[model samples]
Structure formats: C-alpha cells, structure tokens
Target: MVSVPTHLVSADTEWSPLRSVIVGHAADSCFPTAPPHMIKATMPEEHFASFRPKNRFPASLLDRADAEVRQFVQILRDHGVLVYRPKAIDWFAEGGYTAAMPRDGLITVGNTVIEACFAWECRHREIELGFSEILADLEKDPVVRVVRAPKVERPDALYEGIRGFGQKDAVNGEVNGTHTVHSHEWAINNARPAFDAADFLRFGKTIVGQLSNVTNQKGVDYLRSAVPEGYSVELLDVTDEHAMHIDATILPLRQRLLIYNPERVSKRALQKLDLFKDWELHAYPYQPAPRENPPRYMTSGWLLMNVFSLDEKKVVVEAGDVEFAEYIRKLGMEPIPCPFQHVNSIGGSFHCTTVDLVRQGT
Candidate 1:
C-alpha cells in the first residue's frame, strides 16, 4: 500500500476534503491507572474514583469499544480514505494505558508531526504506537519536520485551583472525597510545556486553543511559538470547570458551519472573539442517556460533538445519535452514521479516535 507522503500530511483546515488519517486502536485499552488530577478534573464528581491509579478498565468494555472501532475503520475505507492503525502494544505489561486515541498524542501541522507533551505519566509512550506510520511518511517526503516536546522536571511545588474552591480544598475533595485541603502538589502538573492534540481547533491560518486541566499556559505558549509565520493561535476561554478537550466543545464541520456544546462555552468569551461570530453556530442539543449505562466515567454525553468531517458535505456521526444526524442533514450535510456508543467508553468519538493527516484544501 502506498502511504501518504510526509509533505502531504499538512491539514490546513477541518472542513477540507480528507484523504489520510490515523485511526485509534480500541483493543487492550485500559483506563489510566495513575491518571493525573487534570484527567480527574474533567470527570463528574461521582465518577472521580474510577480513574484512580491501579484501577484498570474492564476487559468487556474494551472488547465492545474495539468492535465499534473496527466498524468506524470500515466506514472510512468505504469513503475512499487511507487509514493507519496504531502499533498495538502490551498495555498491561508496559504499565499505564493503551494507545486508543491517537488524537491526544500526535498533532500534524503543515507536514510536521509534533509529539505532544502529555500531562499524564501513562501517556508518555503513546507516540511510539504510530512510529512505523510516521517513519514511512518521513521516508517518502523530506518536508516533514518532527517536533518533539521538550522534557521538564517536576516543580518543587505544583499548584492547581478549582472553581469556587482553593487548590487545597479542591485537591482534598477529589482525593479524600471530603472537600478539605484547598492546595497542594497537583497529582499531575506540567512543569514545562505539554499539550494534548485535542486541545487545538485548527482552521487553516487561525487556530483556537482552550485552557483546561490538560492544557497549561506553557503548552499554549509553545504552540503559538511553533506555528509557521502568518498563522495565529487564539485562546477559547470556556469557563466550564470540566473542560478537558476542545473537540467536545467547538467543532467546525465545514466552511461557515460549526457545532458546539452550549453548556461548555462561556457566551461572553464567545462574543468577544470575532473569529467565531461569522460562522453559523449550532448548539448540539444532547440530553444524556443516549444509551443505558453508557460510559459516563471517562466522558460526558457531549461526546456527540466529537463527530469527524469526511469532507465539506459529509461527516461521520455516531450511529446512536439519530437526532444529531437529522440536525446535520438540516444543516445541508450528509451524516454517515456509524455505531460508536460502545467506543465512547474509551473516552472519545470519531474525532477523538482519529487524527487527520491530510486534508484537500488550505
């Protein structure tokens, strides 16, 4: 099979026609045993203990998630897309979790593959899963510049503040379930620069990044400094306390069309940014309980916003989201419904499971 050339790996915008992508593996997926407080901050209060260190994801759930991923891959193949899977690792023996979400580790910008600096200890080795695919692209094209995240030592004092509560109270509440200590060494702290791929919303020359538990100030600074000249990164100041990734909050399906979780964004912040005002924004009306016993531990029902656009006129929505599909159709886009409720257990949907390597337009 001819791999996508490294030079062609540039994705200028999300609405462009997609030709190549890296789909995640659901097999052997384990919940982070030592997930950072950043990860915990995104979960619901009642489900906070589920991701504690030493706790592994259920095997039965992993199998179901894998089954859904297989179907998603087939759908992409049917659409004439070239899909690459991660190099399956022995997540159990290796310690930590699996490389099921490539979107969290790799960020491809204008033919360059940036290895994201992870805030969670378990995610440090995730880039290795796609090494073979990246190597092939590099061999085919010299324009590819692989930017590696700089390493940083842990700070003597790590600080994190939760809404309405001091860092001490917040940390104690999460760890002891008592809402006590207000400040302390953060369970997970990015001393230097670190960011997940999902932190960005790329739109050609303009990109929007949100400050969240997973993405720190340094991470945002690093991205702003790294992009090519003429391109700019904007910060989306969403006030939601649990906001972890930008995909579930703001998603641009095609040119002049976007979808967002109304609850996840601050209206005042949205108004100040002229970049998003012109676009026709539609609020996804998601009423949880999309399925009985859906995985609420890892992600919220807003995962419905995590759809992937195949082109300007076609998008891959979760099969369970019939209402969302209809909404997409109303917006004049074709919705390719594929079963993904099972895969949501692993913490993302189509956009979260795959990372676009190449898009048709700039």
Candidate 2:
C-alpha cells in the first residue's frame, strides 16, 4: 500500500490520490533518443546547440522555458503538494534544460511526498532536495500507493518498431543523408530467447484496436505487473500519422477531467478512455497544423499542464506556457499565471515536468 502524510490533518479532508503535478524540465537521456551525434546529424547543429545547459529563464535562455518550469514547480509545492523530479545527466544535458539546483524537484500531492520509490525511478537522478525546506513539514505528508515498476528485458523492440522509420537500424546511429535514428534504453529486452516472440502473445491477443504509439511493449509490461488489480491500463492505438508526441494526446489531467486531442492520440486509446464513464472527458478540437519541422512547437508534452491550482471557479497553470493563462480562461478556470520560462525545449510543457503523486480527496 502507499503512504500519506498530513501535518495539519483533518478528519473530513479526503484525498483523490492523483493530485496536482509539478511543472519542471529534466533531461530524458535514454527515452527521447537524444544522442549528440545523431541529433547533430539530423538537424542543423546551430539550432540544436542554441540552448546550453543552464538554469536561467527565457530572455537569457534560448527558449525562455526554464523559468516557466522551475517557478511553476515552486508554486505547486507552495500549495501543499508532492513533487518528483529526475536527477541525472540526461535530464540536464545540453539538450536538457532544468535548473541544476535541487529546489526544482517536483510537487506530487499538496505538500507531502513519498520518497519510497525515489532513487530507483531515477526521478531525482540521485540529486535530492531543492525547494524551500521551510515547507518541509507540509511536504513530508504522504497519502499514496506507490507502484514501483519491475525490471524487464527486451524493452528495445517497443522503441524499435515505434520510433524509427522503415528499415532504420535502432542500435546505432544509422543515416540516409541528414536523417538519423537512435536506439532507446527504456525498452525491455529479456526473455527465454526461444519463447521471446511468444512472450508478447498474450498481450497481442488483447489488442482490440490500434495500440498507443508512445507506449511500447515495456509500458504494457509495467501494467501487467504494477497497476492495481481493479484498475487496469489499456494501450490505446492512438496515433496521428501527423503528430510527433503521443502522451500529449491522451492526457490524464486530474484523474477524472482530461483533455484528449483525439488527432494526436489513436482512436483505440480514445475509446478506452471513453469506456471509463465515471469520468467526464473534454475532447479537444485541435485542427491539424502544418508540420513545423524547424521548431516543432517547443515540445509541449505535459509539464505545462501538470500542476493546476484551483481557486473555486479558476485553475492556475504555469505562466511559462503562455497558453496557461489563456487555457485556464477557456476551462472557466481563472488563469493564475507565474513568471517561469526556462525549460520548454526539453520536450515538456508545464504538465510534462512532474509525475502526479496525489490530489485532493474526491
């Protein structure tokens, strides 16, 4: 079972478990397929090198995203929440853009964080503590069931078939002129060798429609072992042949209320999410935009929308993402904005930064 912390505990206070998410940026070393050589070869070295590793915000930074990430996270923590952050080279590499300081970890619940699955998940990258310790008392409360993922082998096949194009070698940087593809480290690749192909048979049979593109065989494997028995995870085959990121499509915002960009997510995943009638779904009408290759929409994954502070009728989003202010207004949520904008290029928005630990009780 998970743990919950509350310094000023109240009997009536209930917990939704999936609370607010902190907004911050970290290097995704193995996952995003960022090998310096491969990245440089594919795009203009100048464009890729524009942002050096630093903790500064917008004007000083290449994209003015770091400030957006850090401040947003800090605000969430201030609101009594738990935040989980990645600590490592990839999360802060040249391509990465997180404030090296420790205060920028994450906000999971209101203020309490369960540190049980910390280091193993590489969330802190081994780096610990960054936010104001003055809030430690409130931050220590934990009310969550931590589900740790078990290790698996042959996780590569997922990225292999999902990420790279036809006939491209994933193990090494293979190229055709300017385009290059890199292998992923997150994929599970272990098996009896002989039964390796058969290992996925059970999951294969469950495939009712298109499978999610961002989800690899490894992600599915995670559900097989860790997901709670009553709560199951179904990989929706939601892929918009035109979009780049998948997680952005089937977003899990605040548990019940979610904004799904069906265009970006596969139709199957959309159906799966719809199956849960208990929750209300807000479908986004995102008309396909011309593919902007040069600056790929600054990788707005989820961090931008992670931590949403609700003040009765309004919800606050990280100011770094300009849309935060506007988006809240659209949701009938008063947009409480901030001034952070130092970490957008890393491929995350306000929502992408932190993994939600807990929410207010439903």
Please report, in order, the local distance difference test score of every candidate based on alpha carbons.
0.71, 0.36
Clashing pairs in 1: 33-53, 167-182, 167-183, 168-181, 168-182, 168-183, 169-181, 169-182, 173-179
TM-score of each: 0.87, 0.53
Which residue window of length 10 is worst by lDDT in model 2? Answer: 193-202
Model 1 lDDT tens row, 41-118: 566656665665546678788788888899988888877778878787777666657667888877777776777777
Error of 2 at 347 (Å): 1.6
RMSD of 2: 9.4
Estimate, for each residue in 225-325, the C-alpha lDDT of model 2 and write its tens digit: 44233333344544343222333454334334556665445334554544445655666544433223224323433434333333234344545456545
| lDDT at position 50, candidate 2 | 37
Number of the top-ranking candidate, with lDDT as the measure: 1
Candidate 2 positional error at 143, Å: 8.3
Error of 1 at 250 (Å): 0.9
